[model samples]
Target: MAKAFASQGDTSEKNISFTEIGAGIWAFTAEGDPNSGVIIGDDSVMIIEAQATPRLANKVIEKVREITDKPISHVALTHYHAVRVLGASAFGADQILMSDSARAMVVERGQEDWDSEFQRFPRLFEGHESIPGLTWPTTTFSRSMTVYLGQRRVELMHLGRAHTAGDIVIQVPDQNVMFTGDIVEYHSACYCGDGHFRDWGQTLDAIRAFEVDAIAPGRGDALIGPEMVNKAIESTRDFVRSTYQPAAKVAAKGGSLKDAWNEVRAVCDPKFSDFAIYEHCLPFNVARAYDEARGIDTPRIWTAQRDLAMWEALQN
Candidate 1:
């Protein structure tokens, strides 16, 4: 039997965990689902990665209320995926922040991406109607920006592009904790539908330079300790390299995209089959890697129509 498209069959709810990995830094993880970060400063809170909808974000808010009553004053997005940014309204943050390039992506393909993602993963958008349409950042920076929540300092830096052209990491320099959006995944599969494989590897190297005690990834459990941190980064790099290299090899041989897709699944599935969303991401990952290997640097927009067509062509 053919597999379900994307995450359509993934209706089971995951157990959420709120872990404190640093001084006032919390990681809100939901069993390999989209994860969030809560940085409680001396005065207020800074949220990283809004959930898929206002309804879903409320759960995170409830968790926050359990810890501190400080109003959430800021939100930082790592990239422009719908599941990550569409829930901004629930936070009531004065400053919704992202890299300027991420803002450009929102302008370029945000609507199509929203449609595509919603169609691909209906379970994630349970309260789709609550979404106030496309989310835009109130503050945009090019390279890096620093914010002070009273005495605590949070640094937002574009470490280099990986998951998206404008991926950024929120670093609590003093605490040595990093909230890496989708740039890195632990046991969860890396979603590379809009990724730059070559650039992603280099970006991982840059992330390795940081002396981190804990990391809050886009998905998966909070990685605590330098050992686990290195493992996650290396595992993420391995996933990207392993997926792309085989597809690139096939493309270089002038193989069909379908052939490359099959090749990637054969090689990757054995190693990554148990990872979260591994099945949902493989087709898109293979498609993007095929395009990139064929010298297509920029990823094509994935509208809902394009999504179905590509899935059918590759998987059916």
Candidate 2:
């Protein structure tokens, strides 16, 4: 039998957890669905990473209400993926912020990403009709942008290119807690379809420099202590290396995509087979890695047609 396309078969709803990882900070995480972070400023609220749609984002809002009634003043996008940004309208945020590169991505391939991702993971796009078209950033910053609610400060820093050219991390310097959007997923597969493997490693190193007591990663449970935080970082780095290296080696040797996929699977499955979205991400991850290995610096846009063609060619 041919494999299902990406996460199409994952229809079961995951249990959502709204965890208070720091004094006024929280992580809204579902089993492995896209995660969002809440920073409760002294008088207002700031959300990091919106859910896939308005309806889904409402759920996060509900959780936020349970704690405080501060209106959501800002929404910070870690990158320019449809699942992460299309839900901006739900927040009704005063301003939507993203890195300059992320804004460029939204301009370049926003439509293609929306179409392809919607087709690939229907479950994630449950409230498809509710999405108010493409999410746009009202504010764009180059390297870092800092927002303060009262005396509480949250810094959005584009440490470097990793998951995407515009990946950003939200840091609560006072609390030593960071919300790493897709930059570091704990016990979850890093979706590398639009990633930079080589630069991703360097980004991880830069993230490690911060004295983080806790980290709310892109997926999985929140890391509460330094030990767990380091483990998640290391796990993410290991997965990035394991996936990219094997594929790059095969591609450099003039091997086919199938050959590269098989090579990576052999090494990754043993260690990461149980990780969330491991199977769903393998094909696209390998495809990008293969391209990068062959000197393709920019990742090609993934249209619905390309998604199916790649899956058909490497159906396991």
Candidate 3:
């Protein structure tokens, strides 16, 4: 079943494209907005990456309704990001799954992340009142966990740190479909505020090692073929490199954050100018890049006040 949804901003229905990439598998994409993927197994369904709000998650459930009425048995959070996990209740899954590191992040700064993200991206959280509470994973693993929904194999692995300390990817072996949470984005700008720039590159390499036919990334379009998959992976790789090198140079030279931001804009803007959310991500990305360059391990907590201060300092 192929369907499309057009919102107010997306006058063209083509903005959102839903496709059955493999047997009993689907990718729900809306331009560069957040994306969700579905896997219907022998008896139950696994909903990956709950959308930012219940309203958004409904859009995913609507498509699942078209194919099969199997109840949502499990909900998986690729990492602990407010926009990703806060809507877990909407899925109504009996068990929620995530990496151990992700669970730790939730415990460490879940409240601050919730408040900070809500303040930054109200568009993603339309009906905050519906969010029951902070989502907690019922099941968590250290490195790799293989889940069996009867016969379908859903492999969850923590390859390396990328978007967040707990960043993980979902691989459907039979379908050859991989759901790379925020580890790999299609055309959307890579959000690195809580990312490890060095470890992120290795994570990308690990993701590419899998034999994937299609990919449902955390954002942007659903990559259908190997070509498109490679393109997305490389695009993500480029974003990370562009951010890291300049920040590293600034750190080496004892240059200020402002100077590094200037260098990054000079390099990245010319190439990634048309990417979605490029403007919104650059400030945050640069801030994290600067921190990593300065040898700051474990990203600093981002409160709303700190976010505004950084935005004002960098953007202005």
- The C-alpha stretches of model 2 lying farther than 4 A from their native spots are none
- Once superposed on the true structure, which residue ranges of model 3 sit more than 4 Å away at CA? 1-14
Q: Predict model 2's lDDT versus the native.
A: 0.93
Cα-based TM-score, every candidate: 0.98, 0.98, 0.94
Count of steric clashes across candidates, in order? 0, 0, 0
Error of 1 at 289 (Å): 0.2
Report the lDDT tens digits of candidate 2 across residue range 245-278: 9998998789999999999999999999999999
| lDDT (Cα, tens digit) per residue for candidate 1, span 71-174 | 99999999999999999999999999999999999999999999999988988899889898899999999999999999899999998989999999999987
- lDDT scores for all predictions? 0.93, 0.93, 0.87
Writing each residue's lDDT as its tens digit, candidate 3 over 1-316 gives 2121112133232266788888999988888887888999999999998987787888888988999999999998999888888888988899999999999998999989998888777678788899888999999999999999889999999999999999889999998999999899987889899999999989999999995999999998888889999999999999999988988899889988888899999889888878877877887888899999888989999888887788667655
Model 1, residue 280: distance off in Å is 0.3
Score candidate 3 by TM-score against the native: 0.94
